[model samples]
Target chain A: MKLKGYRRPDGRIGIRNHVLVLPCSLCASETARFTASLVDGAVYIPNQGGCAMVKKDLEITLEVLSGLAANPNVYGTVIIGNNCEGVQASLLAEKIREKTNKPLETVVIREAGGTIKAVELASRYAAQMSREAGMLEKEAFDISELILGTECGGSDPTSGLAANPVLGKVSDKLVELGATVILSETSELVGTEEVLAPRCKDEATKEKLLRIIRENEAHFERAGESLRFGNPSPGNKEGGLTTLEEKSLGCIHKAGESTIMDVYGYGEMIHSKGLVVMDTPGQDIASIAAMVAGGAQLVIFTTGRGTPTGNGIVPVIKITGNAETAQLMADNIDFDASSAITEGRDMEELAEGLFELAVQTVNGQKTKAESLGFNDMSLARECNFC
Target chain B: MYGCVKLHEKDTVATAILPITSGEEVHYRFGGQELTVKACTDVPVYHKLALVDLKKGDVVTKYGQKIGYALQDIPKGAHVHTHNLYSTMPKEASTQEE
Candidate 1:
């Protein structure tokens, strides 16, 4: 399948033409927000992790910022930052430029004389970038050029039977088409790691996969806690799930039956093109943020509990396996795979329908989240390190 | 009536649908074999229920994932929650239960 996409100068594909106003540090987030607000076509991601975070946290921030800037959805970017923050604005702009030679600019608050000056300079750059972005035309791109990020939230029984499996079908089809599919949320992969590890393409990859899972487990041990007890949230309980292991089992279905080609940390760039697993928390916003940071142009989020979260640089396609949820939260959910469970619809048919919708979205059709202007995003920060 | 959610093919436990009362009979299925479980406690909804006898430290599965291990021996039909069930490996405190 082919859809119209913006071809970046760096040989990447973008489905959205956005002028991004990125904050280099947490301190500059508000200023970037105001600057983005000044332009009709600009978007900004807000978070509190760019400063005072430890090296790993800062590294993740830098990667997420760079990835967002490199994301195809962004046509041009104007990075705004405080001069003395941990991840410098100039450094971020350099990294972004390294990935994509698209139009780029930077403004430091101290150098610009403060928030007002920074906003003025950023708005000027953003407006100019927006105009240039508007002049570019969309061209036909093969489905193989797409990287699909699969996620789920507010899950219930039908998620595994309906939305997740259908997504898995789509994942299989996409991989067959030579596209990339990212199945994220390592915490959700607990009970099923043994099954998932064997599906890796090779022993080394499988070993690496197991190692990461064990590392996550060990990390939890150090904290004197466990991922299981914290899982199957209140919503999951109400939806009839009883344990974390149960949630993990159902969550693994989102990856389909394909072999995991590689695993990546949160906000890391995805180098391999086939199915990959990104270690991320299960929170909708944080998980989606990491996926976007990892360079997903589009995300397919399955929600049984239903949420209205979207990303600044990527379009989040919301699907649900619950028919009642589709009805109760019709405005938030885009595709209704609940038919797979409620109406006994075949997974193949539902998968095809979802695939078509994904193609349409790639071709510039707005998702419900996008249409609602829901640009909810946040960086996952562990703690401050001196 | 607590519904059992199977975690994996090899798992011997299914997650609880709701808090199960001690000695209440609940019907569940596994590997195409249906069985009746007598709840052993007010098993919180979204916890676990032993489909078979579990030894101390036996890994507990739900959604076919190792959510935790039994802190002590758990009998068939026993309720698994914060008390009897612990994470397979200690890790981060639970963050998704919100």
Candidate 2:
């Protein structure tokens, strides 16, 4: 597919050229937001975990924050921090710099002396970065530069039967074209270890995939909890999903039939090509956030019940296979694969059309999530929100 | 025309593509062969229709994997769902009772 994108100095390509106003912690979010508000092309995300986090949570939080700045979708970042947070602005800036040579500037609210002063200083940096961002001419890029993230939410029978299978075909096609595809949602992929393990290219990769799935399950087991309790969520039940197995059986179909190349920790930068897995929570927002941090420039989300999840830095294209949902949630859904069920349409033909849509999305076509101005994001934590 | 879809050749149940009423003859593709069965009960869209009779305790299969276990005798063409089947996996501490 012919496309135009920003080739980052780190040798990654971005479909979107966004100047990011990053808050290292929640205390600096307002400052970052106001800074972004002044710059027409700048964007900011709500940073809820930058301060006073427990050990593991703090580590995951830093990975996510730095990963966001490192994401290919972002052209540059202006980091803002409250002076005494668990994650310091200087440290976060240093972390991001370790990942890329993108334009970066930092401001500490306390050092600036107040919110107003912080906003003023950061806005100047963001404005300059946004201006510099606009100066780069679009150069030709292709699918090989894409690290496509796949997800499913509010799923039902048709997701397993139609939508996800259709997406599987797309995943295979993208992998065949030499692009990287990330499959996540570790909590929901329980029984599929046997299904996914043999497909791994090496024993180390298979072990990583197995260990991640086991650890995700152990997290709940140690809490005196069961994945089945809230999973096949009430919405899932109403949508006809019965058990975690049933839901997972439907979920893994998104990965298609590709050899698993590598397994990544949540929000860890991806270096492997072709099919890989990211250890993310089943929560769609958090899962998408991890993939974005891992450098996914775009996400293709399949849903049987339809969802409006989006990210500030990435475009989430929603697809569904329920004809009724396709019409009822037409405002949210980007592609409808219901024809695969109702008419038993050709899966390959449907996948080709979806790929064409993905190519268009890369070349600047806005998805339903993007058009709706949705910027929802959440981080997967090992402990309490603190 | 298929009224239901059997995802894998070994699946004992097929998912209804459209709502089906009792006494309706449902046609579905099993493997490469088109098979027909009478719906003994109504099947909601996206719900399962039994392609073969199930005695109590029989394991329910979909995508050729064990999905759950039957709670009661399920005749061919009957709607299969939570009411007549139960998940074998662990449930929440308090909601373990059926």
Candidate 3:
């Protein structure tokens, strides 16, 4: 299907055209927000990890910041930071520049003597970029130019039976079209990594798949928690999932039967084609944010209970299989797959309907969450021990 | 089914498994027993159901494994939730008795 999408110089497709003001570190977050507020068309995300993070976490943070700048929806970026931080604004800006030569600017709060000076300087850059971003007209892009990110939140039994299976169908269809599909949330795939490995097209890919999952699980073990038992949060328990294994079984279904292409580290750019996995935390907001940071233009989210999560630059399509939830939270749910289970509706049909809706969303249809301004994206940072 | 909550054969309790309304009817087979329930109360999406009678401190199994224990005697078909049940597992256990 052909839909109007923004074509980035880096060959990425974007559903929205936005100018982003990014904070380099937590210390400069307020300044970035203030800068964005001064501009009518600019958006900024305030985060806690700009400095003091370990090497791996810092690299991930830098990658996320730079990838957001390279995101097709972002017309330009004005990176704001403290000069003393581990990741300097200039370095991050340079990295982003390497990815996309889009309008780039940077400001240092410490060098400018305070938040006020930094805000004034950053706002001037953001406003100019926003005006430039407004000048681009929408152009048609094919489905092959899209990268679909799949995720689920507020899972229940209907998750595996309906919502997730529907997503699996959608994922497989998208892969058949030669489009990229990202399936992350490694914690959610705990017991099912073995199931995922055989689907890899190569032995190397299979090893990477297992390695990615093991690394994430080991990280949790170091914290004295089994990711398997730790997830299915209190809310998930209240919603009926008993063990991590059961949850994993339901969660992995979202990937469908696509061959695994490659595995990416958190916040790392995915240049490979077809279905890939990212080593990501199971936290919905964090995982989705990481996918966006890695350059996913649109996100397809499935939920059994319901969630109001979204992204600033990318549009998130919210879907649910709980008929009552679809009715109760009509204002939140976008597509209804509950009928697949209750009415014995075909999953393929529901998936086709969802795919159509997702294409519509890419063509500028507002999702329930996006309409509600639920742009809750968070950068993932590996915890540190003091 | 969307809201057809079921318990494994070895489980002592079942869950709504999916979101259900106050008057919704859900059918499932558990412990070789085919049962149907008309929800008496508006149950939140994933709340548990008492599969069989259980006295205080009886193990509560879900997905065929122990998730927790009944803190008080829970009658058949009673809603099992945080108020009446607590995880007896090593991690995430509740200390207070109901």
Candidate 4:
């Protein structure tokens, strides 16, 4: 199917054209936010770390920041930084340049003489980028150019029975049309790893899936705990889930029945087509952030209870199967799959409707979360900072 | 109308599509036969209900996967929840029963 999108200079297609005002360190976040607020179509990401991060944490932060700048949705970036921070504005700008030939400008608070001067300089750059971005006309792109991310949060029985199965159907249709699907949340996959691993395209891929699951289990074991302690969270139990295994079974339904293609680490760019897995924690914001950083232009989130999480650049389409939650949280939810349970809506028909809505979203429809300005973001931390 | 959704043919438990009260006759299709079970206790919406008689220590299956174990002998129509079923895995001390 053909859909309208913005074609990036790097040959990638994006559903949204946004000028980003990015902070390179925590010290520059306020300046970045002020700069973005001044521009008509600019979005800013708050940097929560960068001053004293250890080697691994610093590397991950740099990758996530650069990835955000290079994401196809971003038309251009104005990076703001404190001159003496661990991550320099110039270095971050260079990293983004290495990935894409898009427009990039930098402002250092120290070099610009203070936060006021930095915001002023950065806002001017952001405004110019926003104007330039606004000038680009939308072009038609094939479905193959799209990378779709799947996630489930605030789950209940309906999640597995209705919402997730509906998502699975949509996921299958997208993969059949040659789009890439990213299934994440390694912690949620603990008990179902054996069931999912065999679906990998090759032995190596299968082994990688198994290894990640084992490592996740070991991570908890090392701390004298079990994954079950947190897998079926308090909300999950209240929603009627009992164990990690049961939750995993329900969670895996979001991937549909597609063959697993490749496995990637958190925030790693995905280049393969078909269904791939990203090793991410079960925390909703961090998991979605990794997928967005990995180049997913759109995300389909299934929630039995409901969530209002949305990414700054990529649009999050929230789907819920709980009939009551859908009606009660009408302002937060995007699609209601409750008909499958209450009104006996066919799974395939519900999936087709969802697919159509996704196309419409890609063609410029605003999701409920986007309209509400729910720009939630979080970077995955591997360990404590030094 | 109140109903229950059985996700898979192999599942021994079904989820309530709506709140079911004690003595309400809930009908479901099982193994190509239409069957009815009277709710022995109130089953809130989204909670589980036993589809068959379950003895203590019996594994309860939903979504065709193990969800928990029956903590007491449960009749076919009994409500299945923390009161009658508990997680087989070690529980987190932080998650006290609500």
Candidate 5:
């Protein structure tokens, strides 16, 4: 299927055209936010990393920061940084340039003499970029040009039985149409490794998937904790999930029954098509951010208890299977899969409806989260900052 | 519409689509046949109900996969949750009982 989208200079298709005002470190976040607020079509993320970070942490922060700027949705970027931060504004801009040839401007807080001067300088740059972004014409692109990310949170029994399976059908159909789909949240895939490993396209891919699961589990062990304790979170238990295995079983269904083509580290760029897995923590917003950084233009999030999580750059389509939650949280939820259980709705039919909605969303249909301006962003940290 | 739904034929439990009171008739389609069972206990909406008599230590199956094990003898149609079911996976350090 074809959808109208903004074609980037780097040959990627984006559903939204945004000029981003991004901060390279915490010290410059307020300036970036103020700049974005001054421009009509600019978005900003208040990044908490960029200074005094360990090697591993610094690498992750830089990847996500640059990736967000390079995302197809962003028309250009105005990077703000604290002059003495470990991650410099000029270097960060250079890193982003390697990913996209979009317009870029940088402002160092200290060099600009203070927050007010930095904000004023950056805001002017952002305003000009926003006007440029607005002038770009939308072009038609096929579904193959899309990268869809799947995530689940606030899960309940209905999530597995209906919402997730419906997502699975949608995921399968997307892959069948030659589009890329990412299945993330490694912690949720713990007990279902056996169900997923065999779907890997090769021995190396299969081993990689297994190793990530092992490492995730080991991470918890090293902290004197158990994966089962935190998973099936209180809300999940109240919603009828009893164990991590049960949660994982339901969680993997969102991957659909497609062959696993590749596995990626958190925030890593997705180079291959078909269904891929990203090793991400089960935290909802963090996982979505990682996928969006990896270049996903849209995210289909399934929630049983309900959430209004949306990214600054990507549209998050919230799906729910609990009829009550769907009605009560109607303003937050986008699609209701609860009918699958309430009315015994055909899974295929529901999936077709979902696919059509996803197409419409890409064509500029505002999701509830988007309409409410729920631009939540978070980065996964491997260790404490130095 | 059925009051409870069975996700798979091999599942030993079904989830309540709505709150089911004691002795309430819950119907589900199994193997292409619609069957009825009397609720032996109050089954809250989205909660699980035993599809058959479950003995203590018996594996509780849902979605045709092992979810947990029955902690006590559970009659058919009885509610199944943390009180009567325990996860096979190790418990969290904080929530572990002495």
Candidate 6:
């Protein structure tokens, strides 16, 4: 299927044309946020890790920051950093430049004199980039040019029974259409390696997928905890989810029935098309952030208990399968997929409508999350060994 | 419309889509067969209704797999939440127990 999107100079397709004001570390975050506030059409994200992070965490932080800027959804970027931070603004711009030829500018908080002066300098560039971004025209692009991210949060039994399965159908359809669809949440997928690994396209991909899930289990074991004994948050329990296996079985539904193409590390760029897996924490915002940084232009978040989380720089479509949560949190929920279980609606018909809504979203239709201006985000870290 | 929905034929429980009152008859369809069970108590919307008489320590199945074990003997069509069912599995999805 064809969808209308903005074609970046690097040939990537973006469903939204946003000028990003990125903060490389926490020190420059307020400056970046203020700068973004000074300009319309320019968005900023909070950064909590520009300095004093452990080596591995710093690397992840840098990758996530640069990747968010290089995401196809961003038309251009204005990077800001505290000069003392390890993630320098110029260095970050360079990283982004290596990924895309989009317009880029950098400002160092200290060198720009202070936060106020930095905000002024950064906003000037952001305003210019926003104006330039507005001048771009939407072009029709093939579905293969899209990277769709899938996630499930605040899950209950309805999520596993209906909502996720519905998203899985759409993921399968999108994969069949030759588009990229990501199945994330490695922590949640711990006990399902047998079920998921066999779907991998090749043995190498299977091995990679196995390693990530095993490593996650090992990580928890090291922390003297058990993922198997302590999952399905209280909200999930209240919503009828009884075990981690039950939750994982339902969470994987969003990947649909597509074969796994490959596996990627946290926030790494997803190059393989069709169905792929990403190594990310089960934390809602962190998982969404990893995929968005890895190039997912749009996100479909299925929540059974209900959540109003909107990932920064990506349009998140909030879907729920609980009839009461749908009506109770009507303003936050974009779609009520409860009929799948409530009335036993035809699965294909339900999925077709969701896919069409995705198409409309790709064409610039505002999701309830976007309309609410929610910008939830978080970066994953290996440890606090700094 | 059925008061509850069963996803798998083997599931020992069915999820209630609407609030079910005590002593109400809960009807659901499983593999083209309609079945009925009298609610033993009030079941909240989105909660599980016991599809079978479950004894304490009996593994309750949903989506055709063990979701949890009965904390106490649960009569057919009783509200099944944390009150009478709890997970005793070796692994879980959340970070820690609350």
TM-score (chain B) for model 1?
0.70
| Runs of candidate 5 exceeding 4 Å displacement | A228-244, A384-386, B8-13, B18-25, B29-98
CAPRI classification of candidate 4: acceptable
Model 5 accuracy (lDDT, Cα): 0.85
Clashing pairs in 6: A25-A50, A227-B92, A228-B91, A228-B92, A229-B91, A231-B93, A231-B94
Which digits, one per residue and each the tens of the lDDT, describe model 1 over residues A1-386?
Answer: 78899999988889999999988887999999999999989998785778887878878888888988888889988989899999998788777777778888989999999999999999999999988888999999998888889998887666765678778888889999989999887667765565687789998888877776776666676777665555666676555454555566577777677878998888787878789998877677888888887888999998887878787789899999777888998889999986554444556777899999998899889999899888888777644110
Per-residue lDDT value at A100 in model 3: 84
Model 2, position A46: C-alpha lDDT score: 90
lDDT of 4 by residue, A1-386 (tens): 89999999899999999999999888988888899889998999977887788877777888788888888999999999989898888889888887888999999998999999888899999999988998999999999989999999998777987899889889999999999999999887876764687789999999999898888877767767677556667677677666565677788878777899999988887899999999888888888888988889999999988988898999999999889999999999999998877755666778888999999999999999889877787887766210
The lDDT per prediction is 0.78, 0.85, 0.76, 0.84, 0.85, 0.83
Q: Per-model i-RMS in Å?
A: 6.2, 3.2, 6.5, 3.7, 2.9, 3.8
- lDDT of candidate 3 vs native? 0.76
Output the lDDT of residue A62, model 3.
Answer: 86
At residue A209, candidate 6 shows an lDDT of: 93
> Which pairs clash inside model 4?
none
| Candidate 5 per-residue C-alpha lDDT over A235-314 given as tens digits, one digit per residue, 9 for 90 to 100 | 77777766666778788888787899999988887888899999888888889888988999999999999998888899
Clash list (residue pairs), candidate 3: A25-A50, A239-B46
The C-alpha TM-scores of every prediction are: 0.79, 0.87, 0.78, 0.85, 0.86, 0.84
lDDT of 4 by residue, B1-98 (tens): 43777766678888877788998998654434556778888888777889899999998887666776788899988888767776644443323252
Error of 3 at A325 (Å): 2.1
Q: Report the lDDT of model 3 for residue A8.
A: 73
Query: Whole-model lDDT, candidate 6?
Result: 0.83
- Each candidate's DockQ: 0.16, 0.31, 0.10, 0.29, 0.38, 0.29
- B47-83 in candidate 1: lDDT tens per residue? 5678888999887765445666777899988876656
